[model samples]
Target: MFTLPFSALALSLCASAASALNSKRHASLAQRIKSEQPALRSPVWHGLGRDTNFQITDNCTGSTFFDCFDYFTDADPTHGDVVFVNESDAWSLGLVSTTPTQSFLRVDNSTSLPSGQGRNSVRLGTKKTYDGALFVLDVEHMPFGCATWPAFWTVSQTQPWPLGGEIDIVEGVNLNPLNQMTLHTGPGCAPNTSASDYTGQQLGTTCPSSDGANAGCGFLDRSNTSYGAGLNAAGGGVFAMHWDGGGVSIWHWTHDEQPCDLADLSGSPDPSGWGTPAAAWVANGCSPYTYLTDHQAIIETTLCGDWANSNYAAAGCPGTCSDAVMDPSNFNDAYWQINYFSVFVES
Candidate 1:
């Protein structure tokens, strides 16, 4: 038998303890990997020919929302009778609030007054601009009322509207229950409806700015649950927009029907795996890369805007747009409750 000195024995014990700790740590890591195996197996690219995977680059919620977006205090460029409030004003006026789990952007629903400029609301735009990427919004409620015109869209920060392009993911006016997705580009770019894969009805073939207001190629989702009151009754849902060199596409999924892939926040999103989109605009005579660029996400609720006002008669709402918008009680449901809004970039 070999006898070791006291110091040598102590050193051996210390080495054994360290080895045990390391082994335990490795085993814990292995267990985590095993638990996440199912999610890891999901494809990152759905055969889009892009070698990169989509990873969440921004998760805008709660405090993160304020950090990512800037409040627009300027008048509505769409000729909406709206008074866009700043961050401080929004909170003070109860137009905006954030909890640990959710965020709220709402219009004034407690006061009764004439709709002159419009109701008090908040309009938020992302501070950072994006060229092409994936945008996903998990909403619990969206603004919808007799005189409300709410929109979740994107536009190029560049000067000259439409020339920089605009993409309206969720937009409607008055009592419209369905969403209308549209794309407005500079010129030459148009919806190749024949080549696009979607369930929406194409309203136009041209996307030039010269086509006039609401002139961009449009696609209407006939599903009532895709927007407005129906959407809220169904407990809200997820709206996803995928933009790349191929073109831009939009998808909607009811809260309960959302794909399992989207439930895993840590996993990469694969748009290719998503079935036929609700609306898609494939490049035709024009190049998407040139038409859509430097766009920033925007969320706003305007009262009796150009769209809502012009279509008021058809909406069958009592009185004029201004009259309907002035009643605070009527706009109690005119608010947006967002669970989360995320942006993903190619990896």
Candidate 2:
């Protein structure tokens, strides 16, 4: 054995101890960070852009929800950074009604829009600049009332209408949270049953249920508050949707709450957890066509008619487009607030 002076041995031991301590400190930091906001391990899709503009709701152009000929945000779209307002509650912003034969937006701007837009019309720019695993949008609150439909949604830039795929982040009727995650394609839409929707990952692919299915396929998910309440962009929560080519899923996260992960949705997406696709979406026309590969922008505010028009009482609901759904009596006068619209890619 090599003998060493007492002073030398003490110095060597001290150096080793210091090194070990530093390693432990570093490990601790890594753990803390992991717990706070874990990194996206299998992040297939990612957010291409993000903005936290406090003044996003500073433009106007569309018509009100009260017998207006045009929308308020028509002339001034507020660009990519601007949040289009209803302006004067006169232009319906082109939003038509879908049910009960009425079209409206209840002119109200508590968040930012001095001007109100309603039913299927209102723009905050588009997700056109981004393309990846998927796109997620979080908005303030959706307008609610009979025939009142608000949505935080997306549309394909390359393809139009059903071909491109319509992702309705928030869609409901009456004053309920029957928030729905639907994929509209071809002639068939709204699969009506959990089994019809073929979305396996989010719906439970562990084993097909007794119904001989891969979980609800189409418009999976239906709920009032428990699930819907937590997902309404109106109340301010993370009503996020996932899309990465062959997969699609919707998640509802409450304020300051972590979102339910794939494991949580292991079972058949709760009864209301993006429950199942609608009945019409299961037919051959709709199945195997829910992947949105080319949407221009992500709709982050409340939209009426275009998707939430209820049952189509407005002139534009069934067909005619020129009969503007603008009316000044109704307005949401609300501004959609965002913490951060971020995107993460799968590495």
lDDT, candidates in the order shown? 0.79, 0.36
lDDT of 1 by residue, 157-251 (tens): 98478888899999999999899999998867755555337778887777886524556888898788999999999888789998877778898
lDDT of 1: 0.79
Tens-digit per-residue lDDT, 188-240, candidate 2? 33332333333222332121112222122334343343223344432545454
TM per candidate: 0.84, 0.44
RMSD of every candidate to native, in Å, equals 12.5, 17.0
Q: How many clashes show up per model? A: 0, 93
Model 2, TM vs. native: 0.44
In model 1, which regions exceed 4 Å deviation? 1-52, 115-117, 211-213
Number of the top TM-score candidate? 1
**What is the TM-score (0 to 1) of candidate 1?**
0.84
